[model samples]
Target: MLPPELPPLPALTHAESDLVDRFLEVLDLVGRINPARSSDTYGGLRAAQALVGRAAALRDALTLMHERGESSIHATTLARALRVLDGERRAARVTLPPAGES
Candidate 1:
């Protein structure tokens, strides 16, 4: 039997797409840099260095959107996009584990 179909992603402008992609890149790097969860100092250091560029790219994406007059964020739609991209699980990695867990 086939698996259930996933919902289509919401329509987004080019800038919105760039923003989401850049944000996810930053989120993944942050997760990698979480010292509480990471064991390798070198790896964490690498991730920390990469984060600077990813953050700048994220800023550039937002700046492009602003320059293009996309002033209002469609939160509901963006949240859906994030969910579809496994952002909830990715974001969880950056947080401290619940008390008594980690």
Candidate 2:
């Protein structure tokens, strides 16, 4: 059972549902990758970091919705998540080498 502070899963629109699905897919991919064997050079760590941030943002949005009793109002959380993702992209570009490179 979810804790009392956590929100229940609210009904999502088609597009919102798709977004959640994609978010989960990215998270799953990040989870399955082996950093030592295959993900060391392709910004995998950064991608995983970004995905984690996204998941956090999604959770925040849901929580806010619960608090506000407005499941549809998620712009603030989405904006924050986008900023985090952009930072992750920039960090990856600066810190990681191109895929297949040493």
Candidate 3:
């Protein structure tokens, strides 16, 4: 079953709200396919890579929002979350077998 929608964050503009929603959706998928949490090895690795890509996309979106004068508070909070997801991506990469070793 799909998880419930997250409550809206404080002080977000309409455009920021949409970006946050997309970021959360990608994060939810990352959580589900996390290697430590899920037993499907190869699948987890693939999902981790996808997560990394999504997180990078989110970072770009957040940067654009900030450039367009979104609140610093919101930008900082989302940037922190993106960093956490990047850490997860790194850990997942470490768990994967070296290229040509699998």
Predictions in order: lDDT: 0.93, 0.52, 0.63
TM-score pick, better of 1 and 2: 1
In model 2, state the lDDT of residue 20.
Answer: 54
Q: Which candidate achieves the best lDDT against the true structure?
A: 1
Q: In every candidate, how many clashes are there? A: 0, 0, 0
Which parts of model 2 have CA positions greater than 4 angstroms off? 1-11, 14-22, 25-42, 68-102
Candidates sorted by TM-score, best first: 1, 3, 2
lDDT of 3 by residue, 1-102 (tens): 997665444555655665765676576667667554666778777777788778877787778878888746566755555454453454454454556754
Q: Better model by lDDT, 2 or 3? A: 3
Question: 1-102 in candidate 2: lDDT tens per residue?
Answer: 864453334555445544554555454545434353344655676666677767776676556556655546465554444344443443343344667866
In terms of lDDT, model 1 sits at 0.93
Ranking by lDDT: 1, 3, 2
Q: Model 3: how far is 33 from its true place, Å?
A: 3.7
RMSD of each: 1.4, 12.0, 8.3
